[model samples]
Target: MTSADTWIAAAKARADKRAKEGKVNIGTYTGNVKADDVIFSEVVKPSGHKAYDDAVKTIRSVQQAGFVVPPSAAAAEFTKAWQDAGNRVLLGERKPADAMKQAQQQAQQAIDEATQ
Candidate 1:
């Protein structure tokens, strides 16, 4: 019999047996509706369950010079760093590069005053 037919037969058997015994709770006897519940072979396996060998190979390649990280977390870090720098500038913290340029302008102003 097919899976469903097998399940129907099992259910009927459970109900019949329960009725004979006058057992009102038939839920427990209805367990294992599938006739062929053995051998849990994976059809596609769970996603993200990477093999150990595959992980080792990927790690080794990441250490190589010619390795490519396509759309990786490195891109996210770079974007975050750029945003942090812009935020530091906005927070009025003394930015060294900007301070250096301002100092150079002030020195030039002093030099222009001295020359004039």
Candidate 2:
């Protein structure tokens, strides 16, 4: 089978296992993809901008590292930084590079704070 087919098979197997574990299938499964309860609960969409996306990814990584919770001060600050930069870019108030740089700096600050 092709790589794509193999992946789909693996996903199906996982879905079956989850089902056996009493996980409800919240969505239907198509031929190529499965839309189970767990899959449906995840936030998988991109923010359409690299800076915001990277900021979010950084925050998630830090949280996963057990440094902060979703509603923690550090997480809020990092999110605010990215959102501010994204809003500036969207409003044409700043260049994309400038916004990205600001967002990155803010993310770094958050990371430093969490690490310390």
Candidate 3:
């Protein structure tokens, strides 16, 4: 299996475990937490790839910066940032490092703007 597949499997396992424990919403892992939070915390584990790791860290940082619950524009920005990075990487148009760097900057900017 590919690394992404491995990650997905691991996440599914975690989600199932969480569900069994009643920590997750029935039929979904996104329970009381934001989907990104679940993905960052439970889905994206360290895979020994520097770029992937950095991207995960960037995502976590943004999520921690109040991108969770929101009528906040920051949340929208975070979504865009994530989609841009993921799309670039998936399309092989950019290295994960490059994509994630841009995403990090955008997400941070959004947080700053939202807080201001």
lDDT of 1 at 10: 58
Please state the error at residue 70 of candidate 2 in Å: 7.3
Error of 2 at 32 (Å): 13
Runs of candidate 2 exceeding 4 Å displacement: 1-73
Residue pair clashes in candidate 3: none
Q: Write model 2 residue lDDT over 1-116, tens digit each, in one string.
A: 43444545555666576567865332222332333222323423343667755764565445434433356557877888888999999999999999989998988899789879
Off by over 4 Å in 3: 1-72
lDDT of 3 by residue, 61-102 (tens): 564445344566598888899789999999999999999999
Q: Can you write out model 1's per-residue Cα lDDT over 41-99, one digit (the tens) per residue?
A: 11111223356436534543453344332353344444454455556667876595775
TM agreement with the true structure for every prediction: 0.22, 0.40, 0.40
Count the clashes in each prediction: 0, 0, 0
lDDT of each candidate versus the true structure: 0.44, 0.60, 0.66
| Local lDDT at 95 for model 3 | 98
Q: Pick the candidate with the highest lDDT.
A: 3
